[model samples]
Target: MEFDYVIVGGGSAGCVMAARLAENPRLKICLVEAGGSGRQLAIRMPLGVAGTVPAFPFFRFANWAYETEPQAGLNGRRGYQPRGRCLGGSSAINAMLYTRGHPSDYDGWAARGCTGWGWEDVLPWFRFSERNERGTDAYHGFSGVLQVGDQKQPRSMSKAFIAAAREAGYPLNDDFNGRVQEGVGLYQVTQFFDGKKRGERCSVAAAYLHPRLDWPNLHVITHAHATRILFENSRATGLEFRRNGTNRIVKARAEVILCAGVFGSPQLLKLSGIGPADELSRHGIPVLSNVPQVGENLQDHVDFVMNFRTSSTESVGYGFRGGWRLATEAVKWWRTGEGLCATPAAEAGGFLKSHPELDVPDLQLHFTVGIVDDHSRKFHPGYGYSAHVCVLRPHSRGSVMLGSADAADAPRIDPRFLSDERDALTLIRGAEILQTIMRASTMAPYDKGEIHGQDRMRGAELMDAIRSRADTIYHPVGTCRMGSDAVSVVDPMLRLRGAENVRIVDASVMPSLIGGNTNAPTVMIAEKIAGEMKYNL
Candidate 1:
């Protein structure tokens, strides 16, 4: 098969690239995904996140809930890394928080020599992609594919979280995406509130790809597992993939863009002989380019969650009152398109400085109405609320390595979480801040008692709890750093350093992880790259 552009891994970035590229009728685009179309009920329902986030082998859809290599920093525990494997990617499985990290994040990229990536430079791309429910503002767009709106009915606990934050002396800012990012408030979600899809999840595929499926210039191929990039010398010519039992090759006449995400992208490159040479030789794979940094610089938010069981049914859970409420809410969701199932359980969050003197916040907070133990993999009998505090810009870094040369094998992922002492220290201090907020009068009524990390509120014990239970909050990036140097896998233009005609438009290309949930930034990256491909490049 031959196409002008072959887009691999029909995730968020791939969907955006295909849709935008297809606008030009002359360019035929083929988008291939290893997963199914992201039209499952679980992916469309806001609360179906419970069903999708757990992902494959157990739940069988949406998520690729892979685990990390045992980490010495986390007391030898393997961390869970759940990525969306469907068309919408993690946007279908995430909390729907629509956050753009402090503008300084993008400006930092520009300062580091990535020329067109300053906050002022990329703001338009963000606006071009978002349709905020509150309408267009300096920071948001009202006419775009992605819908950004408020939750239909957030739980009382979520509101109380904001009150509790204020009671703890933090200022209240309605928009985290606005001028100042530091403060506490309810997050603006990427959910729909109008038309037939009202109260549903607005994943990137739902926003960008589904509507364009019938376009004559676009071809979406699902359930096609990418094996490797087919290269002509150092330039990526196309890719080889398997569907059912047959391996097929799709030739790219113009370019091949990899949107297979952090793990998938790097793994595909290495399998195709474009990674660390010494490591490739060990796996018996021929060295094509000997790029030492193909899978290096893995960064993620080192998250620590604290759960609290509440005495009231205002929170989400499964006791008698809670069960009745849930059943009634299901009916309400079906009847009027409002209630528990209509909202992502994590309805509120904030960004805060670990130290008051810092210019920008280094810690991000998520307030969920349900008790999230082990990513909701483990459950309890009662209703409760939970709060999460993650070191947004972690000092620690890790890597994604090959388990073997075979394309079917899972990559040897090692997030090396909490390996940096600075990360641990910031997280430890953030935990203290969370405890202080929980102690506020506004949070007292809902507090039955602590569940996880109970009584471990002090110095060494708090550190121990973090190490023993800390895991990723699912934002992973930098496995293919885009920089202005030789070691960087991609250039500022997002073009692969050693390979021509190959561009990467996923979170993996971030030189550093942003200070909030990664979905929005990842989408922005795709939009900016596609815009350049059409208007600038």
Candidate 2:
């Protein structure tokens, strides 16, 4: 098959590119996805998101489930990093919070030489691609396929969390995507009207791909895993892909956009002989572009949880009763689109500075009404309130490298988390801040007692407990960063440093992880990239 554009990985960015590029009507585009179509009920229900991981058949099958190399700093524990394998990619499996991050985030991106990616330059596109339920404004749009809306139902505990934050001296923000992000509030979500019902979280697949299924000029091939890019004289022309034991080649006449995300994009590049020459030679892959920085500079947020038992019998608890509560919540959502089911597990959160001298917020807090024994769903059955304090702008760095030349092989990912003493110190400080907030007057009314066994511990013991329980908040980026420097993988326009007619349009290109959730920013990157591609074409 041949097309004007061959977009690999029909994910968040690829979906946007397909929808936006196909607007011309004359262009023939092919979007190949390694996963099947996203049609699971769990993906559509806000609360049902928890089931997404267990329902693996409905997800993208091509996901290279990579584990981080054992980290000496993390007690030799290997982290499980899950990237999406389906049409919408991680956007389909993620908590649907829509946040554009702080303005300084983009300013930093621009300052790093990502020319057109500054906040002011990218805000318009963020607005252009969104149809915010809050209505139109200088920062939001009213007419776009992607739906951004206030949560359909606010959890009862949300108010308490907000009050506690305010009582702790942080301001209450109505909109984090607005002028400032340093406040506690209910977050907006990526949702749309699904059959007259509002607050129906919309995935990239539904918003950008499914709506265009009837376009004759566009071909969407699912279950097709792109193995390697076919390049000649530094120009990408086609790719080799496999489906059901059969290998096939598809040609791209114009360009190839790799939206395979942070891990897959770099792995594909290395498979196509575009990474570190030394590594490629060892793997016996011919070097097409010896870009040593293809998979370096990885960063992510790490979180520590502090749980408190609430005296209110109405508190959502764990076990069989919790199941019943969740069932009732689901019924409420089905009938009224309002209830606990409509709320993300984490109800309210805030961004704060670890130190007063810092110019921007460095610590983040996510307040959850229900207790999480383990991040995994299997162990998440307790009834309590919890706060997750995360260190934003971590100084730690990691890398991604090839395990072998074969596309089927998983890449080695090492997030060297907390390697920097500063990162560990920041997290420890964040835990102390959370502890102070829990003891505040505003939160006293809701506090029944401490839940964690080490609740009575203070000072050194508390810090040690925090360190033992800290886990990832699931935000990872910068493995294939974009910049003007030689060490960078992609350039300011998202093009690979030494590759032509190919671009990476996903979280992998993020030069730095933003202060909050990455879903909204990933979508914004796609929106901005589409405009740039359109304008240049």
Candidate 3:
């Protein structure tokens, strides 16, 4: 098969690229996804979203399922890393919090030599792709396919959490995606109001793929796992992929874009013989390029939850445990998308600095209506209000290396979390802040006692408690960092530093993870890359 573009991984970025490139109608584009189409109701219904996790139809089967090596800094714990496998990638399974990150985040990218990616240049794409339900403005757009809107009705717990943050001296931000990202408030979600469904349901697949599937120039192939990139004279030419027990070679006359996300993209690059020379040679794979920084600079945010029992059972946390109340709520969601089903797992969040001297927010707080013990609902069942504190600007760095020459083998991932002393200190400070917020006037009305058992401890004891409970919030980036430096994997234009006819358009290209959720920013990156590709083409 041959086409104008052979885009690998029909994730967030690939979808945008394929959809945008095919707009000319004369160009042929092949979009390959290892997973199947995200057409399940669970993926469409806002409340049914949680049920899609265990459903092997996508997550378990098509996902690469990469886990980090036990980090010495994290008490020798290996973190569970889940990347999306379907048409929309992580955007398909992520909590639909739409955040563009702090303006400084993008400015820093430009300062680091990623030209045309500064806030000024990138903001246009952000507005271009977004069709805000609130309507268009200088910072927002209403004509795009991607839908952005606030929750239909803010959960009671979310309201209380915001009030508590305000009482604790934090500002009440009506819009986190607005002029600033600091403060506590209800998050804007990537959803559309569905009258028949009683709630909002939308995703990148719905925004970018579903609307354009009928386009004759666009060819979407699901269950097609790209095995290797076929190169000629150090330039990407085409690729070999496998689907349903058959091997096929496809050519990209223009470019072969890799949007397989942070984990999958880098893994595919190394498998295609484009990575560190030593690592590739050890696996007996002849190196196509000697790029030592192909998979360095891995970073992520780690969150620790502080749970509290509430005396006011009227709070939203009461419906968490399974029973008649939970069943009733589920039925309500089934009938009308206006109950617990419409609520995101982490509803309310705040951004703050761990220290007074910091210019930007280093800590993020996610308020939940239910108690989570190990990220599994089956493990813990109870009525509890919890706050998850995550260190935003972690100083830790890790890498991705080839496990072997085989494309089937997963890459060796090592996200050296807490490797820096500053990260540990930030978490300790964030935990203290969460404790303080709970004591504020807003939470006084609902105060019961320490539910996660941190109230009983103080000083060193609290620090220990935080260390024991801290886990990743699942935001990983910078593995294939973009910069002009020789050590950088890709340039400001997302082209590999030493390669031609290739580019990486995913979270892995982020020089650093943003302050809050990364889903929105990942999509923003795709939109930005699409514009750049169009202009260059």
Best by TM-score: 1
For each candidate in turn, the TM-score is 0.98, 0.94, 0.93
| Candidate 3 residue-wise lDDT, 179-223, digit = tens | 777899888888766445335556787789878998999999998
The most accurate candidate by lDDT is 1
Candidate 2 vs candidate 3: which has greater lDDT? 2
Question: What is the alpha-carbon lDDT of model 3 when measured against the actual structure?
Answer: 0.78
Q: Which 10 consecutive residues of model 2 have the lowest summed lDDT?
A: 54-63
lDDT of each: 0.88, 0.79, 0.78
State how far residue 252 of model 1 sits from its true place (Å). 0.5
Off by over 4 Å in 1: 56-58, 319-324, 453-456
Which residue ranges in model 2 land beyond 4 Å of their true spot?
A: 53-66, 193-197, 309-317, 377-382, 444-451, 454-459
- Sort the predicted structures by lDDT, highest score first: 1, 2, 3
Could you give the C-alpha RMSD of every candidate to the true structure, in order shown? 1.4, 2.4, 2.5
Shift of residue 407 alpha carbon in model 3, Å: 2.2
lDDT score, candidate 2: 0.79
